[model samples]
Target: MIKVAGMLLLLDFQLLPPTASSEAAKLDSLFFFLVALCGTVATLIIIFILYFVVKYRRRTPDQLALSGRSYRTLELAWTLIPFAIFLFIFYWGAKLYFNLMTPPEDAIEINMVGRQWMWKVQHPEGQREINTLHVPLGRPVKLAIASQDVIHSFFVPAFRIHLDVVPGRYRTIWFKATETGTFHLFCSQYCGTQHSGMKGDVVVMEPEEYARWLNSGSEGSAASEGQKLFRQLSCNTCHTGDSTARAPFLGGLYGKQVNLQGGDTLLADDNYIRQSIVDPEARIVAGYKPIMPTFKGQVDEEQIMLLISFIRSLKEGREQIPPVSDPAGPQPSPVGDAIRQSETNANAGNQPRTNANSTDQE
Candidate 1:
């Protein structure tokens, strides 16, 4: 029991506040106001109870009879005062919640995906990640998240923002990491057997460091070698063109309008596309089945970028030549005649010649 209590207490662990971003400041204000209001009310209630207990206590009296009486003024004051205090708290909390929910108009949008054990993140430039997230300071970052499997929660204690990631639904949560430092993340829900092991870090950096990180040939960069591997897997085969694929095409989809199956329209920008790839059922593409499988473990950030680039390159009238192993000529398929001929040559003279093999054995 003690161990469980300790774990619950550590769930929303918070460290010192970094610099004050807009969201962080608002959150701090809300927290402070709530703590003060509740503290004051609790103290007053305790004092009132103690005072009444002493004042009305029965004293030793041989011929006294006890009678109960109510003070009209005291009752009215207590009732009205507590009601007013609760109302104030409600109004204040609601205002802050509205501010947090309605993201700023100019906020930079990023797609966030949650799975059983990790987070799949995608940047506006098509970069992707598994368990790490990156964003620039002083800029509003919005996350559109969906779960690939069971229900999961996206929580960053430093930011004071959290939301549930449910399958077959789209949920949006935004936060601006004010200070440029690393913060811890938690699932916040009993997800699976590896729930405790499902942990990751959020790296917040300055604009310059973030930019350098993006261009520093790091493995998670949008244009790194992992993207090359992604292209090698040929994701464009079914995602683009009128290729009879079930899901929507990826051409010109980055900032274009998307029509979902349920008569709703959304921008087919970075966030939408990323979620669709990682959690296809979150928002179904119009006129298509949610048959697109999740690529959770098979793909990396760079590969996701390569896939995004390929998709982005498919904008109207832009035919992108896939960067596969080709030497200015047609590339044969793996099962084409060349492979078949090689296999036949390797077994050329190994077959038994009519009855000669039997006679030699005798």
Candidate 2:
């Protein structure tokens, strides 16, 4: 509010939406440039049209009209000038796009699952929030998003980030916050009957505040959950320890070239690993039988993300998802530690943590 003389007046007036992230400001700059350029061109065209209307008007009723003519120089100028302008715009837009899409390697990964009319946000430390995301200010954050049912678009206007959340696959987006505040989150796509209700808030906090906020309600790391699921499904029976003779070793398998059954080697990427789990016969590993059963209906997309995180951590060893300690003292997750000691015990011929009811498969 601003006081003018003895009157109080509202000071909030703008032609653009609020921008809270670095990406938002950059995008706004481009958008503003486009609006200015187009407005200038349109204004000039209108003025010229009015000028010609008056200058070349039929002043006398008996005066003959000018014959239709064309100027090659004018034609070339119009064509080439617009063409050059378009090319420049394309290059600038493309560069901005690639920069936004390519996230820094050090960026922290955050997961989001869209279902019904709410967004389920999961932090790397395993804190889950419904329709709310808490991120540290000035730090790069990557979002791995997926949907449970229909398609939903994750739209954050203040951050200038909008992405589709499809049911069958995972899509990723990134942003680095420049302003610390709460921003609105919405589903731009018409998801369902309650699409309008699919809204959330992004809270950007200071580094110290964010660190303390993370320790509030964590369920444990996602990898720890994945590791527990591995034991529940008896995945460790054939993927590690004593089962390498029958199935391929899973440790350090991610991002590596693995020979297929037909003299072909396939990269164990996220897609390949996902297909291998849901549809085992899609690509069989060399010396391994096509006996692995499909787990499509058994595990959901969120579970698949957890499994992938677990797999990615496998290459870096069990310490990938270590216990997060706070100022109080060292606190360990019950399901944390990535089954290190349990696997060691199993290797020592002690009773393994495999479920007896589970059928063994590669």
Q: Write the per-residue lDDT of candidate 2 for residues 231-320, one digit (tens) a residue.
A: 566665566434444567766677789999889988887678888888889899888888787888999877877776666545423332
Give the C-alpha lDDT of model 1.
0.61
Model 1 worst lDDT window (10 residues): 331-340
Q: Write the per-residue lDDT of candidate 1 for residues 169-286, one digit (tens) a residue.
A: 5678787777887877778877999887677888888866675554443332222232344456555455535557544655446567788888999987545666666677889878
Per-residue lDDT value at 138 in model 2: 89
Relative to the true structure, candidate 2 reaches a TM of: 0.80
Global lDDT scores for all candidate models: 0.61, 0.72
Best-performing candidate as measured by TM-score: 2
Instruction: State the displacement of the C-alpha of residue 302, model 2, in Å, after optimal TM-score superposition.
Output: 1.6
Residue 10 lDDT in candidate 1: 84
- Listed per model in order, the count of residue pairs whose N, CA or C atoms clash below 3 Å is 1, 0
